[model samples]
Every structure is written in structure tokens, then in C-alpha cells.
Target: MTVPAATEGTANRPAPRQNKRNKPTGVDILVLVLTIVGAIAIAFPFLLILINSFKSPADYNSTGPLSFPGSLYLDGIVNFWERVNFPEKLWNSIWISGTVAVFAVVISVLNAFAIGIGRIRGNTWVVLAFLLANLLPQEALLYPLYNMFKAVGLYNNPWSVVIIFTVIQSAFGTYLLASVFGTFPKEVLEAAALDGASRWTTLWRVIVPISRPTLSVLLIFFFIWTWNEFLIPLTFLVDNSTQTVPVAISVLQGDRLMDVTTTSASALLGVIPTLIFFLIFQRTLTRGITAGAVK
Candidate 1:
């Protein structure tokens, strides 16, 4: 009844056809190639900026924009930093963006909790209003906000930008948080209630802790948006000392447009905070974005 040794050996051998099926197909190869090319296309501009920022003014002018520098030159960066008052503007950007992120996340969390978990009367209408407001373009509110801030004597103040960005960014944050909170487990909330936890206690002790991923995403978004905001900061923070990095960089570029190396250096410096922030929080950001998509 025993099988022959040759037949048994053949049966134990792995199938070459099955292994061949597991190899990447032609479509996968095509996608890999396209992805590599697309990434290079997207990254080339930033690479160009970083390289040329190190070039001397003469080299930058004489050489093609994308060409490698003949020698490492850092004078442009030094001059750009000093001429733009980078330290002061960087501090201004830090405080303004930080304030906006904190206020936006806190306010959005409370609003989302009330609308999503509280299930209060008229919650639907409130969410609808927020969604609609988020759809409105910034240009629509710019002049009105300007006049209001001016009338209140808040114009040319950093708080003015803070308030405007906080309000605008909170609208979207509220929408996102509402979705996340709405999906929160009912059993957990009920258990907390049975344990005599007040709504505020439950929120602080249970909800906020669980919602950290989504809140982190909101915080990063608000910070980056506030940091990069130009129009409101330009209109409201007119004073030279109060201007944020983006506005300061814009002014520097205008005054030194002929100096490509200097302008590029200033622009590159302005981009650093956002780049660093994103790189640091990229994992949490990906999780937060995908959280709402799932149960």
C-alpha cells in the first residue's frame, strides 16, 4: 500500500507554477515605475529650492536654476535670515499657530461632543450650518472680518489673526470630530453613566483620551493652516514686528525679487517648521484620517 519513493518525493516538492503566480505582474511593475516617477516629479521643486538656496547670488544668476552649485555658499541664508528678521517672525508664527491649534481643538471637541454624543435638540441643523460654513471661501469672509476687527481696534494685532483662523479652522475640525465622536461606543458611555460619571467627567476622563488620535490630526491641521495663512495675517497683522513667517517671507521676496538666492533661502526657511511638524506627526495624522473612515 506504500507509495513508491520517487512518487512521494515528487508529491513533497513545491509547485513552481504556484510560486510564479505570486510574483509581481506586469501591472504592478507599471505602477511601481509610475509611482517612482510621480514622487520625483513632486519632490524636484523642493529639492531645487534646497540646493539653490546654498548657491551664491552670482552662481544662482549665471547657472541654470536646477544646476548644482559650484561651491557651498551660505551667505544667502544668513542674509535672508537677518534681512527678514527671521527670529522675531518665527516666534510670532509659533505663538499664533500654537494658540490657534489649542483653541480650535478644544472648542471643536466640545462642540462635537455636544452635537454628536449629547444628541441635543437641533444638533442636525447645527452640523449642517457648520458644514455649509466650511464650504464658504475665505474671500467671502475676509472683508467683513477686516472691517469688524478694524472697528474693534483689533486690526494690526496678532490676536486678530488668531481669532479668525481659530474660527475658520474650528468649523472643519468640528465636522471631523463630530464624525469620530458619533461612532463612539454606546456601551462605554452607558457604563460610565452607571458609574455616576457626570457628562463633563465622562468627556474629560473617557472621550478626550479615546479621541486623541483624531484630535492630534486636528491640532496639526490647525497649526499648519494658521502658520501658513497669508491673507488674514497680511490684512490684520500689518505691523512689521507682528507679521508671521509667511507674510514676512512674502515681503522679503518682494523687496529682494532680483536676488533669487536670497528669496529662495527665505522661502526655504519658511517651509521648515511645517515640514518638521508634519514629519513628526505623520503617523498620528495617518491614523486620525483613517479612523473616521472605519467603525
Candidate 2:
């Protein structure tokens, strides 16, 4: 009797057991139930806004928030759009948010590269100072920032809000990115140096490419945060032309004077742009987050 070497190696081993499917346990069911409930809770307000936005004020008052509209009514949307010059507000939001996201990411990358990759002196203190800056109340800084902008003639300008939020967002971004850069693969950086790449060249050709996923995440967050900002934009962008979608919705609606339907329509309109932006970028957002886990 004879056997091949591979067969001989396996001859003494017992047969492998088949994998069993595990049924859901009590904990699994509980977690799923909680997740569903949480989603509904988060979505409830948006749902109400959507439902009521199309209702006439009279219909809304009569039927309450839960009732379906008998027919789609768009006067609230039309009036609100024309009243606020919604197109201009939308453009303002796009410009400010896009500019802030780009500028903040660049500033963060520079700061993080200096502190983390360059290993600059007193970096710990610098990072701590930035962290503390984040902790300071926006209200506390409001007075000084107002005076500073006024002195510079940036007051009542969108640029004022742009500059303020660019610095603010970059502080947090630097804090976050510095840590990521600290854990960067030293071998990769060393290889670039061996290739006679200068610091600037290495940053653009190596570090920036590898860190792009994280930068994408930061950019999207900055845009959304800048888009939703209320107080700073309200103070700085007082004029209708420079105001953002959020400011337009709040200021033009004049809550006291607005019909309930119009108010709902206004809120829904404000939410729609952010929601659409998120949806468009969601894939990139997800990819950026998961990139670290795999590589």
C-alpha cells in the first residue's frame, strides 16, 4: 500500500467540522431594536418638517403635524425662495464652506507636518494651546473678533466669517492630523528622503498623497460645520447678499411673522442642501474612514 506525501500528512488528521450558523441571541435582538428606535428618533424631526412643509398653514393648523396633506402645495416654497433670494444664499454657503474646507486642510497639513513629521521644539505646548483655544467659548471671543474684523474692515463681510472659521476649524484639524502624522510609517518617509526629495517635495509627493483619505474626511466636516454656523455668520454677514442658507432661513423667516407652513418649508429648504451635499460625498466619507482600518 502506498500514499502520496500530501495524502500521508493529512491521513492522521480528523475530518474538519462544518461551520454552524448561530441564531440571534437576546442581546443581538436588543441591539437591533435599539438601533431601529434610535434611527426613528433622529429622523422624526426631519420627517415632521417634510410633512408640514407642503401643507397649507390652514391645513396644518386643522389637522396637526401628523396628517398627510390632501394635495401638494408649493406656495410656501415659492414665496420663501423668492423672499430670501435663495439662490444667492445658496451660493454664499457654497463659497464660504468650500473656501474654509480648502484653506483649513492646507493650514492643518502644514502645522501637522511641522509638529509631527519635523518634530519641532515645544510642539507639545503648541498643540496644548490649540486644544485650549478650542475650549474657549465662541461668545468670549466674539467681542475681540468683532473688533479685530472691524479694525481690518472685514466686519459685516463674509470674509470675516471665512477667516474666523478657517482658523477655528484648522485648529481642530491640526490637533487631529498631527496625531495621525505622528504614527506615520517612518520607513516611507525615510525612503523619500533617500530619493533626494526636499521637505516641500516630500510633503506634496508623498505625505499628502498617503494622508489624502484623512484630509478628505476633514474637508467634508469643515464644509458642513461652516455651512451650519449661525452666530458668527449672523453677526458678520448681516446683509442679505452675503448671508448663508442657515442665516437666510432664520433671518428672513422672522419666526414671529412667518406662517407655520412657511417656517417648516424654510427649515426643510435649509436642510436639503446639507443633506444633498452629505449624500454626494458619503461614499468618499466612508472610504476615508475605512482606509486606515485596512492599510
Prediction 2 global C-alpha lDDT: 0.91
Candidates' RMSD to native: 3.4, 2.8
Scored against the true structure, residue 71 in model 2 reaches a CA lDDT of 83
Tens-digit lDDT string for candidate 2 (1-295) = 8899899889988999999999999999999999999999999999999999999988988899899887898999998998999899999999999999999999999999998899999989988988987888788888999899999999989889999999999999999988889888999999999999999999999999999999999999999999999988988887878999998888876644888888889899998999999999999999999996676
Residue 99 Cα positional deviation in candidate 2, in Å, after optimal superposition: 0.4
Each candidate structure's TM-score, on Cα atoms with residue i matched to residue i, is: 0.90, 0.93
Give, for candidate 2, the lowest lDDT window spanning 10 residues.
249-258
lDDT for each of the candidates?
0.89, 0.91
Off by over 4 Å in 2: 1-17, 293-295
Candidate 1 — what's its lDDT?
A: 0.89
